[model samples]
Target chain A: MAEYAAQGKLPEVLFFVGCAGSFDDRAKKITKAFVKLLNKANIDFAVLGTEESCNGDPAKRAGNEFLFQMQAMTNIEVLNGYGIKKIVTTCPHCFNTIGNEYPELGGKYEVMHHTQFLKSLLKEGRLKVEGGKFKGKKITFHDPCYLGRANGEYEAPRNLLEKLEVELVEMKRNKSNGMCCGAGGAQMFKDAEPGDKEINVARTEQAQETSAEIIATGCPFCMVMMTDGVKAKNAEENLQVMDIAEMIASADDL
Target chain B: MQYIPNILFIIALAAGIGYFTFNIRKIIRNIKLGQKVDASDHKSQRWSNVFRIALGQSKMVVRPIPGLLHIFVYVGFVIINIEVLEIIIDGIFGTHRVLSTVLPTGLYNFLIASFEILAFLVLVGVILFWTRRNIQKLKRFWAREMKGWPKNDGNIILYFEMVLMILFLTMNAADQSLQSLGVAHYVEAGSFPISQFIVPFFDGLSEGTLMVIERSAWWLHILGILAFLNYLYFSKHLHILLAFPNVYFGRVVPQGKFKNLASVTAEVKMMMDPDADPFAAPDEDATEAPAKFGASDVMDLSTTQLLGAYTCTECGRCTSVCPANMTGKLLSPRKIMMDTRDRLEEVGRNIDKNGEFKPDDKQLLNDYILPEELWACTTCNACVEACPVSIEPMSIIMDMRQYLVMEQSAAPQELNTAMTNIENNGAPWPYNQQDRLNWMDEN
Candidate 1:
């Protein structure tokens, strides 16, 4: 972004690699895979680097409105400073916050989840994807709450997956009825409250019911939780958890 | 002596309606105890929701079986209630079949015939509903929050519908018999497609006995409806009256958008301004009293939420779909709404007894809804979406969470750490902001 500013040129999009995409070892792979696709598409994009901040989803959900507003205001200033008009994120948390919750605080931008962005890129003939290793492999897509029920974008990720020609087996719970991976509402930051079963474990058993080879997800949070779920069930030997971006990148050999 | 029954009928009608009006006022006052919110936006969309979700029962039909049955009872019951107007006028003026005298026989007979058909359909719907609740024992009805009065209240409502429909049919059967007997007041008015089958039950009866049966059925049917109307305040059946308004005020924006607090936004703006004085005295007139951040009690919640609580049919659709409850967590969205309305009613009684609310060492938070239930929610909006009437149980859960975190400063230790991480590292985890671009490296 700084280099682009120096050149007095605007990038086509600003990639918001949220916290998990930046720090979590597993989610970083999704970030890298998406970036590879962005490069392949030949679209100029910039990252805010250190200037980016949390969009306050976790704090607001956890009920710390004060901290959430501080973070929201500071980030709004940075976003408005760069005059960022468009954003793409690998995390539904950031995608939802920036698009739905930021306008009242003056941080308004056109935001898209990476799956939606990738689908659009494919639509415009900017990106090409073909099933290489993933052809005819059984898979199930988990709906992220923020992306699916919350924002009513249940089909974008599935639209991207359809391009791979994978045999998509749906869990009993999918779409608006899709069960949460249990890491939302800042649950990712906290231990599970006392319960008969961990939410991820329950959600994982539903995925296992379909006997799909891969459990595909779009959000970074769902990625972490579902990966942990697959491990918990000792199905890592049979089942794989992959993000839609990672699946696309590997399929196209990007 | 001839005018005595008319006088008694008038007295019963006035008493029934008057008491219902009194209770309705109390319910409105209790709901008004909650805090106010702006439900004035998206006028067209709100009305559209009223049509789609409430009037149309669009969300209900997602399950198909119960949804369709409910629509049967809903449409049948409402359309059938048109006959109640005739009953009311007849009871008052001491006239029999007044509407039949006014309208062309074809339209009048059509209306009566349709009402008879609806009455029979409502009977079938009620019987199936009762079986589903009592015999099949749906898991939602047997949930922990539904054990006591709620369970009985549900069955009682079914019984009420069953009895009313029977009385309606019986009344028609007696009227049909009198018409066959060439009785003058009964007059060949209205069709009896359903009740015609019941006329045989009066085979052994004489003129006096048939008249007695007809008069009793007429009186009991109207009075039974009045009893059901009053019973609504104490039953989950209040949705019959309140679902319309509740759906209209439902969240119009995308469900993911939690509200931004204007009060907090203003303070943050002041803090971020570089030219602001740190030592300056606050403007007394400009600044209002510091408001409590979140809800620990029913009064702190929005009136729309309170209205939602009253509007809850306790169908338990929200709880059944809730991931937290499905996994055996303590949380139940149905319980959340029930507790809110219960606590609000308690507060209303307190005000009624002694001028205003006197704190009773208990509140909606710890007393009615436990923090464990509040913490169990993942805020997935499943309950909100599953609700047939657009009741937002998640909003109430989040508000209680806000109360715990902001006012009580009693957030879970792990959550506190997450908030701190956001404070220091601009993320929920302990990642260095400088490393945010580390993923960009080819390695």
Candidate 2:
């Protein structure tokens, strides 16, 4: 972004790598895969690169208004300073916050989840998705709460998956009625209260009911939770949880 | 002497309607006790919701069996009430079969037959509903929050409908019998498609006896309806009246967007603005009342939220779909809404007793909805989506959590730590902000 500013050349999009995308070891792969797809498509995108900060989703969702505002204001100032116009990210939390909540605080941008952005690119013929080795594989897509129910974008990820020519099965609870992955509302940071069973386990069992070899999801939070769920059931040997970007980037792999 | 029944019907009618109006006003007053919010925007969208969700019952049909049965009861409830107008007119004017004289006999018969069929369907619907609650004993109906009054309230409302339908049919049967008897006041009014089955039950009764059965059933049926109207104030059956308006004012924005606290935003801006002087004195006349961060009691919640509480049918659709509740967590979104309503009513009573809210030590937070229950929410929006009436339990949970974090400084320890980390490191985790770009360096 700094180099682009020096050249006075605006990138087509800003890849807003969120906290999990930047720091979490597993989520970093999703960020990398998304970046590779961008490069492969030859899209001019820039990262804020040490200038970006937290988007205040966790704090806001957790009820710390003071802390949330402080974080939001800081990020808004940075995004506004660059006159950022468009954003794409792998994290639904960031995608949701920056897209829906930031306009009130003076940071306005055309924000899209990676899946939506990728879908638009495919529509524009900039990206061509091939079935390749992933053809005919049984896969189920988990709808992230923020992207699906919160923002009503259930089709973008599923639409992209349809290009894989895979046998796309659905859990009984899908679309608007989809179950939660249990890591939302800052639950990823805190221990869950006592319960008979974990939410992720329940949702994962639903996915397994379809006998899908892979549980494909778009959000980093769902990735972590669903992975843990597969492990909980000792089904790791048979089941795999991969992000949408990870699946697309590794379409040739089994 | 014939006017005595007319006089008694008028008195009962006035008392029933008069008390219902009084109670409705009290409810309006109680709802206004909450913080005011502008629901005046989004007229078209809100109207669309009123039609699609409230009028059409689109969301109700998600669980097809109960949904369809509910439509039977709901549509039947609305359409069958048209007969109440005729009953009122007849009761007031001492006119028998007045509608039969006004409309074409065919049209009147059609309407009457339609009402009778609807009445029968409503009876069947309520019976099935009772079975689902008592016989089938669905898990949602038997949830922890549904043990006592809620349980009986469910049964009582069903019984109210069942009895009303039976009375309607019986009244029709007796009236049709007198029409056959060539009685003077009978006037040959309605087509008795459903009540014809019950007509033979009065096989040998004379004119006086038949009139007695007819008048008694007429009085009980109308009186029962009036009583049911008043009973709505106390029962979850309030949904019958309030669902329309509650859904009209439901959350219109995206589910993920939590409204920022403007008061907190003002302070945050001052802190962020480098040009502002640190030593500047605060404005004296800005306001004297301390800024409350989020909802601690019913008074702090928005009127829409309070309206939502009263609108909840206790259908448990929200609770059944809730991730936290399904996982056996202490949280039940239905319980949150119900608890808010209970606290709000309590506040209403306090205000009524003392002419103003004299702070009861009990509040919605700890007194009704436990912190544990609030914390269990994953904020997944399942409950919000599952609501047939557009009631938002998640927003209430978020607002109470805001009160917990901002007003009381009492969020769970890990959450506080996450907030602190975001403050220091610009991330919820304890990672350096410089490392935000470190992943880009990886070969």
Candidate 3:
């Protein structure tokens, strides 16, 4: 893990596989790429697979502090037992908890959202992403509050998208001020308060106003919420929410 | 001859004493009910924050026009206490203009003029605060959250302020009337400007009528302060006194961390002792009896956490800064404090009246704060960071989370599955634990 970071290679990454990211077989393929990339770079890492669980984010928010801490302590002990020092994850919820919150439970680690790792791979020239011949598609990146404000990571996904030659348009509220997808804090798993307009719906409307073909983001939570927003607005035909890696892997501008 | 003045002075004295005593008692009761004090050292290092922010009216300074207005009122309000003392003195002696005997002509005039100007500023400041809370025009800042004051509370404070201003104006008018009619100097005769304006109207008035107006204004002014002091306890304006101590003793470290679990002694009181049929232990007994993970009630919070709620100015800055709240998550940091306060208030009443302790029900989430809102928090310290008063909303969320996850073992299905996976395989998947290293090899 230490050697990989020093060489600008992927570290001994522990992936936080969340429920949303777990059900899809495509998740395996996406993670398989991550594993292949780390292997090619000779970085030491492990995937906790089903062994990696929820980071008690939902429990904590639900006023279940005991469950939150128990899960937190359990994860911390497991990570330490495995001698894991760094983490890379597809799920922003897990990523935020392990990196930002675990320390509060005496579990400190270098945790990165997967886009951060991929961006590092690109920066190191270790992973060659094939961008086929295509015109630059107008894309607006939705900054996930967890990855962006909570964790202060706003550039990795955008940098990768820019490098891919995608036309990047910004919503009125971007970066730290980015609107929420109404999927955070376990809202993805529960019904929201009764209101005519939902937050994610508002955010999708903002994305629609941007007139972008794709809403690219780094976090899976954003992907799910934005997708829901798109579906609700019936704009799925016009705007697509794609993860940065998926965009890079399939960009027409490549 | 002085009996009437003496009677009014007795009333004012009684009111002020009674009012302050009642508020102090209420504050103590609230504190005892679990308004916390953050043991974190951050508060002490910035001792000047108390004076600068609360006393100096710094937070209000963010909006200069309104800020300046408030500062004027606050300064004037404090300075007017001196005037109250003089009123009390005169009421006792049945004589006015008592201060004129000690102070130079210029000094007395300066004191009165300064107070008058300060009073004017205070009136303007309070009007703005009032309008900001009630009018739709200031909705840009006030909308969507408790921006300034709740409607009822704001109105009460505004009433106090108006009374104070009215008393000041009426007394000045009455004093001027008496002075213009060649009344003997008791306090400085030329000290009041409004009094000068009323002097012409008093030219034909009898001395007795002038004296009656003077005494009436004095009574009103003194009575206003007394009422306000008592009302401050119940009003949102409690921040006036609470903000100082809250800012003075804020958390020292980053607000994310919870206090370390309390240490237990050697005699392990295990309900699951195999010798006593471990598996047969009831759910409640299965866990440690004196379990110290989550806060079951208000008293469970540290002294500072409780204080944080009281000290909160309902600025909505916390809600505004919260990532979860911004993203449309149910979590509103401002509402969390408010709810805690509401619950704390109830808890205080329950303990005082019945001494009953009820286990927090699972519905606490749905009732106190929605489950979605509670789960929406990323444990980010943005709310903590944005708070000018240093209230750590995240800590409260985190502590409650600890209780739900650890004690109840009732978390979301996804989180439960994930946690189980982590426990059995060191990862979140169904694969062999050793294969965890395969990803590293492949990468």
TM for every model, in the order presented, reads: 0.98, 0.99, 0.70
Worst 10 residues of 1 chain B by lDDT: B434-443
A-chain TM-score per prediction? 0.99, 0.98, 0.86
The residue-by-residue lDDT of candidate 3 on B1-443, one tens digit each, is 63975886787788778778875776577666663443455545667777776677665665477667767776887897777777778777766667766678788788888777777677777877777766745532454555445656767778789778867876787777665566775333546654456556656778888778776777767776777777776666667678777767665542423344432111112321237655554566454555565654567677777788777767676786554565555678888887777777766665567666454453234467654555666554557656666677777776676566666775667766655654455434455554543443342
Q: Assess candidate 3 and give its lDDT.
A: 0.66
Each model's DockQ?
0.87, 0.88, 0.16
lDDT of each: 0.92, 0.92, 0.66
lDDT of 1 by residue, A1-254 (tens): 77787788778899988888888899999999999999999989998889888889999999999999999888889878888899999999999998988899998899999999999999999999887888899999999999999999988888888899899999998999899999999999888888789899999999999999999999888988998998999999999999999999988877
Candidate order by TM-score, decreasing, is 2, 1, 3
Q: Which structure is stronger by lDDT: 1 or 3?
A: 1
Taking chain A of model 1 alone, its TM-score versus the true chain A equals 0.99
As a whole number from 0 to 100, the lDDT of residue B85 in candidate 3 is 75
- Tell me candidate 2's interface RMSD: 0.8
Model 1: lDDT of residue B284: 68
Q: Name the candidate, 2 or 3, with the larger DockQ value.
A: 2
